[model samples]
Target: MSHHSIEARDLAFSYPDGTVALDGVSFEITHGESVAIVGANGAGKSTLLMHLNGFLTPLRGSVRVGDVPVIKSTLSDIRKAIGTVFQDPDDQLFMPSVYEDVAFGPMNLGLPLEEVDARVIEALTQVDALRLKDRPPYRLSGGEKRAVAIATVLAMRPNALILDEPSSNLDPRARRRLIGLLGTFTHTKIIATHDLDLAMDLCERTIVMSGGTISADGRTGDIFTDDALLDSCGLERPLSMQNCPKCGRSD
Candidate 1:
């Protein structure tokens, strides 16, 4: 399989009420790279991710997954290529049982029963949620539901993974488990989050957003160390970086 890349060119969007969400945003994510989109609330991070998967059409400019533009004609293919996991597992885990939820995408792809079953099992195992296959989604704990939500997308075998606020509302153990799980995926990953520590751990590059524009984009360490930029973006250095005097971390 060829590597997957995403490109946005001069993207602009605004709400019907005339609130601009993105302003001439442009960037390219190389194949197999994990990048972080970080900003305070209302920085346009979620709006940009929605555009990537064709959930919302840009008012101007365009988004392309590989060579396919994210227009109506190519939306089906774009959705298949980009699997997005939203912050709330409840948004994705609608199927009754874990097994059914994980199987939904593969089943829709029209794979044979045997193939769909195999994909379901494999995806569930990847997230260490195989045992939850027989359980009801509503009965699961927050972390378990998150893992299953990821499995639902993984069974589709997408070329890229886009996550929003992935580590939100997790306990310490659950957070660490998620970090480990995300690390195992080889797909091109673009995570939009306010969790700086999670971004530092999972992504080599960080793109800082402010007021619907990309204010800074560079190595995670460099971006975090730019006190002026951080302040301008309404962010501070992560506690991990602050605690470690010699962190000198760069991706």
Candidate 2:
């Protein structure tokens, strides 16, 4: 069987007030690939990520998830196949309890009660949030809420995971723990983040966006090493690169 993954071609979008968010952006991620979308604020990274799951329709192009175009007919299935975790945990953790929040996706998919229960348990266990399953989402720490938000999507067993600014507002320990958890997922991952360290730790490929356009796309190592390109995109070299013995560069 031929397995196609996420593909976007000539995508363009604009805000209600005529602010262009994405312009002629195109990229393809193979199945199981981990890619990072890096850009400064208002660089259109979030808008592009939204396209992957059909949350926002493109004004002048197309997007496909596993050969299914992101149209109204395929929106539900597409969303199921490509799960998204918002930058803010509160945006996704709306259900009263962690268990309910985690179960929401599978339940909405019309799975049987037993299957939903199993999925809830499995997802929570994967994120190490099983102990907090009964607790209200608001009561948990920021990291805990982030984990539970991820669990909500995992319960659906999506083929691809999309996360926006996932490392924002996390302490060092919590951030490291999240990196470890995300490392274990075999599914394709597309993380849009300003956290270059997280990008270096997780993604093999890096895509750089600027002014609603793709300015660079290549191996993570090369992209991070190109100081001029990073500078152009309002990014800096990954700390690991800067502190490398071989590169011999410092602040």
Would you estimate the TM-scores of all the predictions? 0.96, 0.96
lDDT of 2 by residue, 81-165 (tens): 8889999999999999999889888989999999999999999999998999999999999999889899999999988899999
Off by over 4 Å in 1: 243-251
Q: Each candidate: what lDDT?
A: 0.92, 0.92
Give all candidate RMSDs, comma-separated: 2.8, 2.2
lDDT of 2 at 214: 99
Candidate 2: residue 211 Cα off by (Å): 0.2
Give the clashing pairs for model 1.
none
Worst 10 residues of 1 by lDDT: 242-251
